[model samples]
Target: MLRSTIGGLLIAFLAFGTAAAQTYRPAFDPGALKGPRAGAPNMVMVLGTPHLSSFPESFDPDRLGGLLERLEAWGPQAIAIESLSGPQCDFMRRYPERYRDTVEDYCWDPAPARAATGLEVPAATAEAKRLLASWPEEPTPSQRRRLAAVFLAGGEQASALVQWLRLPETERQVGNGLDDVLVARLETLEGRRNENTLIAAPLAARLGHERVYAMDDHTADAAVSDKEAYGKAIMAAWDNPAVAKRKALDDALADEIGTDEGVLVLYRAYNRPVLAQLAFEGDFGAALEEPSPQRFGRRYLGYWETRNLRMAANIREMLGFNPGMRALVIVGASHKGYLEAYLDQMHDVHLVDTDTVLH
Candidate 1:
């Protein structure tokens, strides 16, 4: 009887240990799983958080709550946001001093009554006003200085800082010609407030205004034409040896994976001479050639690759030395698809199911 009881206790101890081991797995690991290197940082918590379009009025709060809970439970040391590189972020970092009131004051706030009794504006306008009213007061000087260092550093370094600031209210009233057009579009969009992207704002806001890092390269301007030209150049460089080498490396890893599970490669769809010259002729090498947009889609795609690689490198550099760090990247969905493919082939990343997260 004594021997039997001891054996039972041992079995229970082993079972409990196994369960605890499973529960304690790190969210990200940069090591291997089967061979000698198995269990390094081989695991990465690559979640695809939604952008403005991912929210809808009918969005499942439970689903979103679950997602956020899981992420927090995963205890990711860092979160990456999509808008960290924008002017909006810059303004937030230097509010009331370098700039005026928060973006919410300019964009989300409703225009004050013009004559004490014009018909009350649309509900969308009213909502925008409410949002502006909610913005926190401007940052302190020390905060501004800290944010300046972040913005100056550029890349994920800046992102880490921007993520900590609160999101400005959506712009509603327009003060200028550009503002007028932008406001009109925003109002039109707001009427259909049932979209998931808009609904997700609260979730993003809840993720602590500062815990999320922006995951984009700050150098790229939104100028459409310039981007188009740059895209062309990248496409042209596809034939260069260095480009061949990068592609080969990506392909070799894909081959080894046996399953196209974790890599994303972005290729340019347009080629511009100036951009081509800059990417290929500059430090990046001849592989960065400009391709013809006329032949592709008349839109710049190569810029995506250049931007993504720079961002990825920054992220690696920022957190590579930190022990037990997990990262989630949010970006344009089109880019997400390509990036996922390329990242799958990387050394220590496991692509989480983006589609699952989206729903």
Candidate 2:
């Protein structure tokens, strides 16, 4: 009698549950399916670079020629550099008085370079394309100088810096329309930013590209909940050891860039899988081990991911305009892993084999 009573109750409960489930409806909406409107997956190469000038000493841009040549051979449709976005450049360009003081010290001087090329910032870039299209083999030194001047006037300082590198050391002086201080500042900026100004800018110019995309962001770093405490914790945890390791690696890489195929070797090692692992996964793993407020290690990683996601979004938007575009992203080594990882998730993006270029 007890068993039958329990079985009856079970049957009643099951029947009620089944009725409830049957009466429910799911709000499912499968929106229209879409395919790749952009022809081929965009190819992107994330080249990891060390912030060299962040150290006490900086290397000459010319040391990166071999690596730059390899990148140029890849023939990227666009080159995304780790700088302020296009709007920042335009802001500085239009109102030097307001932004000149705050903008990176390397923002181009419109006067001298423009005077040399007989074109303003807007016109100079167009003229540069025309010149490259009709470039002569074994052109006179004068032609090189003009193109360099045009590159500078068009706000591609790093490319102009390459033109400066082609001349003899003694001839690398600023004169006529170009200012001495301006020339010095270009080298300074390249070191500070750590792009192969030699690689990115010159290659863009060589391929008739008007400008390099700037995709760096500091807003994420600025928005930590407890900014001071978070910074102190990060510094205490990573700064010293990080600085020491980076300095040693940079010093060694600097020494290597002088030898045959040294630049290639340096880049290969710089872009190695182990380095990226250390930057993203390792940092996050270490963060997970922290305690209390100092445990902002996760937050640190969060901020990093946020910044890279935004950058990837920018690259995606850029691609929206030009289908099947190939872009090479020159970024701080720490950022390379995050950017590549985030971009890889996008359906229309196909990351280039960085090892091949590095090798």
Candidate 3:
């Protein structure tokens, strides 16, 4: 008699829940109210790219010439890259247990710069900003060198490179706070294969821009209790046919990355509308459906969403500072779709169509 009563209650509860789910609707949608009622809209283009470091050693950097030309023609006044800000890195450093690995892997130590300039991250960042605020129409090589040193002290390597690149080859000497160690580091960055060094910094220098923004965030990294179990669960979820298909596509594209035309083709493929859905199926979507006792997949999905949302917010905050500017954001291909969707919801942001620019 008790079992039958419990069963009856469960059925009624399920029916009521189904009705509630079907009838609910949001009161309004913020995305529909597009804007900048007075002037030109803030234009942003997100270029999804594979990590240049992943390319084979034989890959020629000059092949990027055509790609750089196309991007320069777009006339972006500001550029942002997928690198953690100096401030963020400094903040994360306060909690060693939580962010030790992140710092070791992603953050550049400002120790040497601090020793040279006698300024920590915050102070160096402040100095760099203050110098740029009243920057002269024609800054001497000494001024550029000073700014580069401050940027290094602030842990902004790419921006330092921009300053380094803008100077004449002969002017890249050690002085004005740029000690021998810092100068040597700048020289090393010249041949680095990373996208920020190869694409963003050089492009900014060519455009006469002072610095490129670093807007990546990793505060959402999670610490799971059962390490082995969590890893096994996520790995098991990824063992799907969709993942295999995606790998096959990536391999084919990578094979053709040796030439300018091939590089452009790879960019085109990564920026396509369909790649987002494919990415979801192969990674996040598959993780969401994993049947784990601890629901490890859900945890992974939560972390992914949190990280992307923070990154999108950082981009939005950058745009909020100056309206009606053309901004170029270069990020890992997997992040492109998520960022575009988030930024599209903003009232004043106008997403530039990648196809028009890439072609």
Where model 1 places Cα greater than 4 Å from the true spot, the runs are: 1-39, 53-63, 85-210, 222-299, 354-359
In candidate 2, how many Å is residue 139 off? 16
Candidate closest to the true structure, highest TM-score: 3
* Candidate with best lDDT: 3
Better by lDDT, candidate 3 or 2: 3
Q: Flag regions of model 2 displaced more than 4 Å.
A: 1-38, 54-60, 86-193, 223-228, 239-255
TM-score of 3: 0.95
lDDT, candidate 2, 1-359, per-residue tens: 99999999999999999999999866752222223674576788888877644533445556667777788888899888776542346556556554555355535455656556577776777877798788876655566666667777777666566565555566655653456655665566445435646457667767766456667654454344577887667655564454556557767877775644876787787898777766643355456554555468777777677878888888888887787888998888888877877877777777887887766
Q: Output the worst ten-in-a-row residue range by lDDT, candidate 1.
A: 263-272
**Per-residue lDDT of model 3, residues 1-359, tens digit only:** 99999999999999999999999988786678898788988999999988999889999988888789899999998999999999989999998888988899999998999999999999999999999999998999999999999999999999999999999999999999999999999999989998999999999998999999998999987578899999999999999988898899899998888899889999999999778877889889998999998999999999888888998899888888888899999999888999999988888888998888889
* Poorest lDDT segment (10 consecutive residues) of candidate 3: 27-36
TM-score of each: 0.37, 0.62, 0.95
lDDT of 2 at 344: 76
Clashes of each: 59, 0, 0
Q: Is candidate 1 or candidate 2 better by lDDT?
A: 2
Poorest 10 consecutive residues by lDDT, candidate 2: 26-35
Candidate 2 local Cα displacement, residue 259, angstroms: 1.6
Regarding TM-score, does 1 or 2 come out ahead? 2
